[model samples]
Target: MQQWQRQKKASPKSQLKVTFLGEAGVDTGALRKEFLTEMLSEIERKLFVCNGDGKGKNPVYCLNSLDQKYFRIAGEIMSVSLAHGGPPPSFLREWCFQYLCSGDADHLQVCTSDVLDMEMSLLIAKVNDATEDSITDLTDEIINCGYTGVVSLEKKDRIVRAIVLHYTMRVLPMLDQLRKGLQLYDLLVLMEKYPDICLPLFVPVHSDDRVNSTFIMENCKTLFSEKGSVRRRQECG
Candidate 1:
């Protein structure tokens, strides 16, 4: 992905040509589309973590990935992919997509389900499911997560909201970098103006329909063994 950044000097208006390092192929247009599709698919799986029901995704907060500016790379890749007839991210959470479009979290309707971190989500769940007997034990967990407010059955709602807020707010810096990368080709502008039209580009209605072995089987050509050979018999079996 770092290699793609070298394209900063290249003209965005010109046609993009894609080529593999070792593989040889002429990219009239199909190869470019294939490259963009594969790139976006991999980024969706690797650079982010699944949220509720494992459908929506939130960016993984890694100090190393942040220092390396992976979020920026991801943004730029998505923009290029979209501009060059490639797929959109289509895996981001609704709140995340909203933040990208508006450049702020002020209007985002976030909830405990929005939190992606397993440990944090589990802790928040415990707080929500806490009873009169469990409130004291859950108090320490909440406080350890940086909540200063008093914890009780009555304050569980407030405590949960604070934790979720802090969790979501922590990703703002990373989102800022992603926004920077998305500045390419006025992608962010279109998103801001036509949020409804561009919604599917970031968040899909049927996110569960992901790429799988079926895609490979359908797209890839099957090679047959020579007729009457042992390999052919084995293949038939």
Candidate 2:
């Protein structure tokens, strides 16, 4: 009877929880660096496969025009990195290679279209006349709509979902800042100064609310009350 029970237990499947490298409550900096390194290396390998070895000799005329275009973009990005005296930023590398992967043009286009649609939504919202309360609510509604769209896409398409999520998280906050009366040029400069505004979006699989709330709490000071800011400043001081 004991042997039979053991066999039965062994036969039944068990659930396995797979954790990605940068999940919450873990030290992710080193892991992210490693992931970026591997990603860049993979991209370089694919580029060599598409365009020829990085030698001065002309590559074989083999890749299709689309493939060639991807290679050119990747090459130009690297050139920019070299001119700046370092490797390209992690996000830029990931974004470029994401489309560079063969057999993914449709996915790339879909992701791009989704982002453009979200931008159009923001623009329309900005153009509409509204009071302070309505504008603030509209900003939140638009962001939530975009967030929900990406979350839905995640069920079927992780790559496109990730691309859209990254863009939405990065740009929508800036739009909110603009809605709060920050000048467009100032917002652009702030974006440049703080390029990692959407870094939390890359946190490994978690609930939509958890990810969204964590990002907003960490990145947005406008969400805090004046009293909260005063307390925090007093504490820090």
Candidate 3:
């Protein structure tokens, strides 16, 4: 990723090539296509977590991910992949995607449900569903997170929402790094300028973006030797 970052801006605007260490096939765009697709999956697994709904994804708050700038690398990968006709991330939460494009969390409409951590989400649920019996336990959980507010049943909703915002706010640094990487190929500018057009790339609104055999056959050109030549027979063999 660092190597990719050091390249001239014009480099990523061109076709991408991929060569496997011990593989034999020539890269006729197929290898590059597959590489980008796999890289998106890798980024998802390494740096992001899926929401409770199992569709939208939020960035994970791992210090290592931030320190290593994995989000930035993911941004670079997405920019280069899209520039080279590869698939988009398409798994980010709509709010997360919007935050990337706008860099303003103040406008996000986040809720307790957006919290994906099992324990955290459970705490949120308990707080949201707090009753006379559950208020005490829920209050202790909120306090553990450094919230020193009066946790009454009437204020549970506010407390939970504040926790959610605090959780999301912790990843601001990670998002800043990602924004830096998205600067490649002027992608951030394009996304900000044409959000509707670029929305499908970051959100899973279009299932067609997933590359398939038909897409490969349509995008990849096959080469063949003369029909009567030994090379043609060798190709068949």
The lDDT leader among the candidates is: 1
Taking all chains together, each candidate's TM-score versus the true structure is 0.81, 0.19, 0.79
Give each model's clash number: 0, 0, 0
In candidate 3, what are the lDDT values of residues 145-213, reduced to their tens digit?
A: 667778888777678877887778887788888898899878798778667667777876746456422
Superposed on all Cα atoms, the candidates' RMSDs to the truth, in angstroms, are 15.1, 22.1, 11.6
lDDT of each: 0.80, 0.35, 0.77
**133-211, model 2: which lDDT tens digit per residue?**
4444444544544534322222324323544555544433222322222221132233333435532222122235432
When summed lDDT is taken over every stretch of 10 residues in candidate 3, the lowest stretch is 211-220
- Backbone clashes, candidate 1: 0
User: In model 3, which residue pairs have backbone atoms overlapping below 3 Å?
Assistant: none
lDDT digits (tens) for residues 159-211 of candidate 1: 99888988888888888889988988877876787676677768757756553
Better of 1 and 3 by TM-score: 1
